[model samples]
Target chain A: MSETQQPRAEATVTLTNDVGLHARPAVRLTQTAAKFSSRIELALGNQSEWHDAKSVVKVMRLKAKQGSEVRFRAEGDDADAAIRSIVDLVERHFDG
Target chain B: MSDGTVAIGIVSHSPDVARGAAEMVRQMVGTSVDVGWTGGNADGGLGTDAAQILSVIEQIWTPAGVVMLVDLGGAEMNTEAAIEMLPADRQATVRIANAPIVEGAVTSGTMASTGADLEAVVAAAEEFGG
Candidate 1:
């Protein structure tokens, strides 16, 4: 796997906020995701499917509880920025 | 001004509801893009009026496009009527998204602020369901 050429970048971040990925945090995530040109998505721990990170409904639907691990993935010109933004927000407790 | 063309509007049954939803969108997208809203019936009741929606549409009209988010059944109907009432040229640039009012407003508004065209903003709002 390490020898393969990767077109996308992925990162995992823990939801430490009291409400996890609820309304406010979800909104923040979606808005930030929209700023980047890449196609970004979020997934639960070891989940095979990814949810659209630019939709609040999709983000909230994950119901990722506090302390749950959410993985972020992006592909396109701004993949790095997209992943960085999600990781920064999650690490900052979504600025709650 | 690359990302300053498109405008977003919100329409609901209650004036407060429309205002609050617009505020949520503004918080997410900032004040760069235009966001207009109108709510309530002609008599200030708990229903939507086509004229009210039309006025908001006209207020937010732009060369790029305008995306409208409506609250319920009445809003949907009246919004279609309002769009029909616009001049043919203006009508061509307007779209009513089939999305939850609040969520749609925020998502559409954010995308529009990013300089997305009318179709892309509508797509982002509809992406909420999938």
Candidate 2:
């Protein structure tokens, strides 16, 4: 996605990767999560608790399966840009 | 005393933990293996490594095939050649079907030492859900 098309508003995305959420991919996702000023939280499965995208262990605990919808939400000055990056990453399976 | 049964060997970076893990598996199964800490120590432990795999293959023999389990993938001695070098029966008899290496091995080894089968031990690691 282009910088201009970055999520202009706080947005949520569902991870569509076939492998579900994992470490190597999570590491890549977490790195992307940190790029924007907007804060990010990843909701795995149907759990009510939101986990910080920056925490590796927490992300691994999610154990998201293939087809599992993981939500990524960002809210802040660069929330749009941040969400765009996160979405792009999930789209590419974090380039795993 | 050996019972003409296949023997298990731990090929790891740390000799103590490797031997200990194998012994633990023995206690649980009542089938002790001759543990070999491949290229891991100066303490008179088995020193076969990836480079020495050919030489190591020349050493195993018996009614029970000698099994070599490693703690890592690319670096450890259980390369394709080593696996291929084992005598056909010994090769077939050997069981390296444990962990992927490092974390997988340590986790499985600890429990396998206590009698858990290779598969069960691997499952314990899966409990980590990675």
Candidate 3:
């Protein structure tokens, strides 16, 4: 079987912040995602459409309210690290 | 001199609003781009001041250019007046973004932090407009 290139890193995290993914958290998420070279995208729970995670506008538009499950996918050499960092950011409530 | 990235100017009718918005941008992007803000009338009342806006524009001016975000129609007019007061060369480099003050400031600042050019930064702010 021939190997096919695909995104190998994915994770889903719940937004636990009081305001969910509001402007402040959205900025943090986009900034964190921008640090990596990988292409990262996000989707709300059970939604098929994914938006660019590195765009503050797109991230803010997601409007993922508190307790909403947000999924992240990354494809590139640093995909795993990117996903890990994003997951960590979410888990930490984006305080950093 | 700027770091070659577009700068952001925030103008609001209330001084507190302008400062708060600028602080928000700073918290989001750190010092990645130059940010300046002015609000309220000369007497410290709730009104936009063209002179104050002009001063902020000059304070944060950069060769890359600057995108100004205004809170209301009056603020926009004052910002425009401020721009007109600048030298023709500077006026050419400054733009008033028709976007909400707080949202536009954040978006413009973030885009500028990535080294986006003036038009790109202005577009980012305008995208927030209804």
| Candidate whose lDDT is highest | 3
How are the candidates ranked when ordered by TM-score, highest leading?
3, 1, 2
Using DockQ as the measure, which candidate wins?
Answer: 3
Give TM per candidate. Answer: 0.82, 0.41, 0.82
Candidate 1 at A8: error in angstroms? Answer: 3.6
Error of 1 at B70 (Å): 1.9
Best by TM-score: 3
lDDT of each: 0.83, 0.54, 0.88
Q: Compared with the true structure, what per-residue lDDT tens digits does model 2 show for residues A1-96?
A: 645443344445566776777655654665566556666787865667888775444666788877777777776778878878878887887773
User: What lDDT score is found at residue A75 in candidate 3?
Assistant: 95
lDDT of each residue in B36-105, candidate 1, tens digit only: 9999898888889999889889988988888888888998899999999999988978898888888888
Shift of residue B111 alpha carbon in model 1, Å: 2.9
Q: Mark the regions of model 2 whose C-alpha exceeds 4 Å error after superposition.
A: A1-9, B1-39, B43-130
Q: What DockQ was computed for model 3? A: 0.38
DockQ of each: 0.33, 0.02, 0.38
Q: Tell me the tens digit of each residue's lDDT in model 2 across B95-129.
A: 55445443333333333333434444445334333
Candidate 2 is graded, for docking, as: incorrect
Error of 2 at A6 (Å): 17
Score chain A of model 2 by TM-score against the reference chain A: 0.78
